[model samples]
Target: MTHAELHADAFATLSAWTPPSHGQFSLREAYLGFLAARPDATARSCAPGHLTASAVVMSADRRSVLLTLHPRVGRWLQLGGHCEDGDSSLAAAAFREATEESGIDGLVMDPAPLDLDVHPITCSLGIPTRHFDVRFLVTAPPGAVAVISDESDDLRFWPVDALPPGTDASVTTLVAAAVARG
Candidate 1:
């Protein structure tokens, strides 16, 4: 399937899913509205917002998560980025981003999304935008080595019990969900 079709399918999957009891009540409604407002949402059409995919990457033992210090956000975050034309599905997009950013190959991803977050960002496209972030779970094999891409200031595997100081709470939640699902 094409990236657009994949996004539509993924959106449907997300729409039909029941949010975890701990999720914010408004997140689903915001994401659905973002979909309705932009037909090209999946293609980086960049109207009200754009489609972005993220992976909560875990080690084989599931005791640690790989996080990047995003240059733009200036905070530690899960590996992810905007969907690319080469991507065939949202899960693929997430996995691709994880691989590219983390420089780790042969990673395994869960097809179902772990969570969603909609937040505003200043785009290089010269627009104020929101990223409809569809998050998936990715697992790295034992002894996986990660090289930091130019997009990040640093890359590291953080203990599940001790994430970085600037790590978002939602990221911790996503990690918990991924661990639970595993």
Candidate 2:
């Protein structure tokens, strides 16, 4: 499918998804607003902003989560980034990003997203933009080894109970939501 088609699919997926039990009611409205504001929300269209897909990667025992020290943000965060051209859906994009960033193969992802967030970012050339992030829950098999991608300064598994000192609250919330779902 073309990039436009893929974006349409993502919008539809978001539209059909039921809001999570703990989610804010405004999230759905914000998502819909994003869809209306940008046609390339699923691709890197960047017409004021774009959509991003992310995963909260959990270890097999469910005690650890893989976090990347983002080079740009300078903070430990979930594995995720911009949706690529060939992605068929938001879930696929999130899975692909998780796999690429974590360097772990054979990962399994939940079809339903664990959380949604809209945040501001300064992209290439210092353009202010928003990332309408759709986050999924991903699981790594026992003994899976993760390699840090060039995009990150470091990659490590953090115990869910003891996230790093500067961990983002959004990441912490996502970990809790993933744990609660399982």
Best by lDDT: 2
TM-score of each: 0.90, 0.94
Runs off by more than 4 Å, candidate 1? 1-3, 22-26
Clashing pairs in 1: none
lDDT of 2 by residue, 53-161 (tens): 9999999999999999999999999999888878888899999999999999889989887889888898663778888888999999999999988989999999999
The clash tally of candidate 2 reads 0
Check candidate 2 and list the clashing pairs. Answer: none
Candidate 1 matches the true fold with a TM-score of 0.90
Model 2, runs deviating above 4 Å: none
